[model samples]
Target: MNNFKTESFDLNRAFLLDSSHPPSSIVTKLHPLNKIMAEGQIHEDIPLLVMELDNQAIAFITPQLAYQHIVQGVLNGQAWLVSFCSICNGGAVFSPLVDDEVYSFQEGGFYDAMVLLYDVQSGSYWDHLTGNCLYGSLVGKELKRLSNLLHMSLRQVLAAYPDALLALSALPEQQQTEAEEDEAWRKASEPEWSKGLVKTLGVEDNRLPRLNMGLGVWTETTRRYYPVAQLYAMNNVLIDMVDGQRLITYIDPLSGTPGAFFTDASQAEWQHNILQLNNGDSMRDMVIFDANMMLKRPQRPFQLFVRWYSFALKFPNCEIYGQPVNTQG
Candidate 1:
């Protein structure tokens, strides 16, 4: 592995490859959810990268995002970058402000079988998963990620916020249809079909199946992976320790999406997405009671509902829930 050290990241050049896309493919455009929905241009079942600002929902449809790779835009007066990696099945929303300056990105390349983005302003490369600058002048600099970035279906998002603004496809209908078809094929092709992608990933970690899906929870100090199948076996709710914080990880039956939240309670149980805390209160979602009414606590921990290979590669030695710890020094 060729190491390029930065304050925040050490990039390995061995597995990096140039992507077939040009830089800044999709930048700064949005349409109201009502308008796009009325046009019959969106699929309600597809998951979107969603975020809320002052109760206003902003969503990016995968059909549009997969073709674009990177979508940059302003929402609620803040610059944001929404990225989707079809290979990793990972989506992230990042703050494009670097050193207080708004930066634009293009499809820089790929590293460790994941997408790498480069800021148009400084020509530096960044890891889309962690938003850390790995190569170029901005090395060690990282994008501030919106911790509440959510992976939710348009149907679920609309149910919660009907007034959402969507980032719809700007491409021709034919191109959009083609992109959707390609996405479907990528999902349908199983373990054997992805051998090509697996080959690009240098130094495989066989602790878990390369394509296993899981929720990866992390903090600055440590990280952990919660495999989806294991969560189902445990009734979809688990109380665990991460970075010295006691937390809960569970799959919401309604959406079948995983979520992690900080908690002080000892244990919890869930049925049909309703979490029955050990305390008297019951939580329908990630929100728990705030310590003080005046101050709002973060509802969920920093996490990514990603595939096993992506998480395992990006975060080496990350603990796997329900598995014994690796005691190697």
Candidate 2:
């Protein structure tokens, strides 16, 4: 409901790369797949957070860049905070504009196994998943949600937008090197629960493993959890009725991230590794096409990737798909 006025804010100021700099200096014009093959910095299976702005694309290595950007406050109107926790596999993008003012954020700490961000303007800690102020004057207030963040692999991103200019940081080489090292360490570390390394008090959800990854969809009257393992076992596509609306869920084979969409009409099937439709057309990943091969925006649903245990704790009554139906004689 809040109309953001981004006209006054310069996109260049928010991102490290801008038009003033020579394209060859700051921009890396390469296909994501090629980049991954060349650098070997990250695996092809890991998902990346990419944003397309004004015909350019900025890709962030989720595990590394998420923490770096939040700690460095290297974001503006053009860049929002995209945070993902490897421990829980929870990812979200937070709008910088809060309460009519733009606030810079840094890593605050943790609460209930979730990251807490501290805003520079109000000095308040906010829950990373919910964006609600926890321990500041702004307590009880919530940060506005921005556009739906896309989680996909570099290859999938380049496939969707071939002309997207991959933006890299213009920072000094030493700082960048340190960030990369930190990210590498983070990626290798396993969750405490998974290794039985740490014991903490938390709600127990027996439906699935506490550390298992799942995609969560939250609405006013409904909360649903689609376990990624179940989705994969179901051939990576699951269609079900949610709150009187037919919802289609799938895991992108390229990125391994889960996504959901609401269809005006219930019509979806899989054929030849593509999601086929009754209209004589098909969909590959997030892009949708008609029978004549025209592009269209079918529907957008609120969804995020989170751990099953985290979701269970947040929404105790949430429904889990693929659960066995209790039958009594």
- Top model number, TM-score: 1
TM-score of the candidate numbered 1?
Answer: 0.81
Error of 2 at 198 (Å): 5.4
Q: lDDT per residue, candidate 1, 1-329, as tens digits? A: 11111233335432443433465655456788867877887755676777666677788776667667788888768787878777777777788899899887878767667777877777778888778887778766778876356777666666657688887657788878878875775464253444444454655568998888889877767678999999999998888887667788888776778878777778788856667777544555344443232222335667788778888777777789988875542
Error of 2 at 23 (Å): 27
**Steric clash count of candidate 2:** 0
Question: In angstroms, how far off is 97's CA in candidate 1?
Answer: 2.4
Clashing residue pairs in candidate 2, if any?
none
| Candidate 2 lDDT (Cα, 0 to 1) | 0.59
* Residue 87 displacement (Å), model 2: 2.3
